[model samples]
Target: MKKPQKAIVTFTNPTVKERLKPHLYSMMIKPWRMIKNTLMLTGAFVWLLLLLVCLYFYSVLSKVPDLEKVPFQHVREVAVESVQSKIESKTKLKEYQWVGIDNVNRDLLYAIVMSEDGQFFSHKGVNWDALISAIGENIKRRELSYGASTISQQVSKNVYMRSNSKSFSRKLSELFTTRELEKHLSKNEILELYLNVAEFGPDIYGVKHASKYYFGKSPADINAAEGAFLAIMLPSPRKYHYSIFQNKHLAPRHQRKLRRIFSDMLYKEYISPNQYQSYLKWNYFFN
Candidate 1:
């Protein structure tokens, strides 16, 4: 019988090898693809965790009560010490006094409204015109400039939350807290809260305390000139107060600015011209 024919194999054509090479390469890389997928999932989880943390803080800020409802004993003690430390370092001053809201002069409110937020009563939480103007000015000046934060917004910041550096995240948090505050409190209530908690000087926190520290009187007794002076100090109370008392040259300029702001209030029909002129001529003796 004839021997069985030996089995024979043929080589694949070049075209087939090329096509199969890709499939084989993909199979070889399957382990690496799994690792890559795992890493991507881990990254996504970390990002989600950060988002949850931010949301948690935002919720906490929104629910925080007004300054009166907050436990003053917890915050007031710390705030006093913090402010005192700043004053001692900056001005070498030691004396500090705390006064209540009822003792503050009402006239001072008008001055603050005129100087800080001209449209306090009319506008909502944000001042669009002032915000636009501030944005334009900052862009033109190419530097960080003043913003148009409303009294309500300031109250939210000072009482419920700390001031944040300018960033999208911080701004979103501010807006959330501000909206919550607006919903819970009336405009007048917000203003009252602000007056009760605002920092007037290094260690002087609140209108009542500032009144006694500066003018040796209650906030209710502060005259228009005194109100304007205090309003001027709002921008940089520590710096301006020192300048007014220590640097003779700066005192005149600060006085002039205060006069201009007081006059502007009259021009805007917020106060009487007689009142404006009276304050212009009134003598202010800083203590």
Candidate 2:
């Protein structure tokens, strides 16, 4: 009789098993869920990083103010820095002036256009052909030596960025700033600002100051020979400045650069065949 009573065992509830089914399924999928969550998080992080990079480039570009109508107080700020440096070093400060493009010598303009950026008028902010060529040359030379910096790019570096860094980040900043500058200013305006702010010698700033100091004449009064000489001196102002004083003539390198300028000018039809011949014949010391 006891063995027959033991045969009546309690059965599990079907509703309870149904309630536990979801929990069991979730446990089975736990690793896949973790993997999916991790992938989602990684994607979000990558998107966020891309957004930050774009924002950084935009911020750098936005710093270049609209120069269409604004008076270049930025030049004065840079001049003040130079003046402070001179005071700290106990050196006599050189003169700096903001001159209009009209006030500068035509020959000087031509020379700079030829020597520095032949396609200055046509290019937006970069010369892709020259840049590509420079890149090829650098690769061949196995050195980061070749430079294809346009006038606009130079202005961006001089005004917004430090000149000491030769990093990829610095170049990227320069490129962004140059695009901003081109968007805000005309080609002639860019040229005018560059002429006003470009460094000439140890303390000499601007073509106006350089012209007055070296030739004892205003930029407006300088001749082709003097203009070419000043333009040539731009590459190494301090060295050429002393050399001009000691030698009383242009160095061989300067002469070679002038010839290159003349050739460019002639090719661009900025000068006539007769003018090119005349320039070739003209000596830096004789005139």
Candidate 3:
């Protein structure tokens, strides 16, 4: 009876691992759970940020009103410089006259297409092949000397996103604006805007002013040789202008570019073999 009444119960402590099992399991699992949650949150944030960026780009591009009937305007950069030049020289320096694509010479159009963007009529807002080639060349040369800007991109740079500073952001903005422009404007309209806004000299803008200033003629009256000359001078108009006025000769570099333009024009059949030959022998108009 006594044995049955008093089986003195003795409590024994559990082993460390056994006693701490729940706490140890919690400690081990908490960090992993926390990491998983953090990763989830980070992924969500990243996706949200990407969505916001896409929305912003879309909004910006959408705000560009249709260009179907809007009057073309000069590049703000050119306008500013014109004003500055006028102020500094104490004389009128700005000259602009708009001309339709029909008013522009066919030769100049062909020359510009051949010289600047060979695929202007075919390509979209961007020329991926040229861009890739330019990238490879720049990488191999370890310099940023080459660009694959299409006519669309150039118009964007001239009109809305004019910045000489090199950066990825600027390029992206230019592409966006270029796409918008192409979406709203026809090829002929884009070409017209480009021709009308492009700078031909320090203050001369568009084919009208350039034609009168350089040759005392209208844009539609420009000859093949004259058109080629204008297209070649486009790369460095101000420099070539000074050189032509002062020395009556284009530098060797400009001469090379002019030859290249003529060669391209001939290759593309924009000019006949005889015309090409004639241009090859053509003298500089400045002299």
lDDT of each: 0.69, 0.76, 0.75
Q: Residue 79 in candidate 2 has what lDDT?
A: 39
lDDT of 1 by residue, 51-85 (tens): 99988786656655444444545445544454454
In terms of lDDT, the best-performing candidate is 2
Better of 1 and 2 by TM-score: 2
lDDT at position 48, candidate 3: 100
Per-residue error for 94 in candidate 3, Å, reads 6.0
Task: Give me candidate 1's TM-score against the actual structure.
Answer: 0.64
Q: Per-residue CA lDDT of candidate 3, range 1-287, in tens?
A: 34557667999899998989999999999999999999999999999999999997776566443455554443334434433433332332445556778988899888877777888888878999999999999999998889988878877776665457567667777777787678767788778767766667776667787888888899899877888777766766788678764467777777787788888888888899999899888876534
TM-score of each: 0.64, 0.74, 0.78
Q: How many collisions between residues are there in candidate 1?
A: 4
Highest TM-score against the true fold, candidate: 3
Error of 3 at 59 (Å): 7.2
Question: For residues 90-149, what per-residue lDDT tens digits would candidate 2 score against the true structure?
Answer: 333435556788987787788887778888999999999999999999989988898899
Order of candidate numbers by lDDT, starting with the best = 2, 3, 1
Candidate 2: residue 138 Cα off by (Å) = 4.2
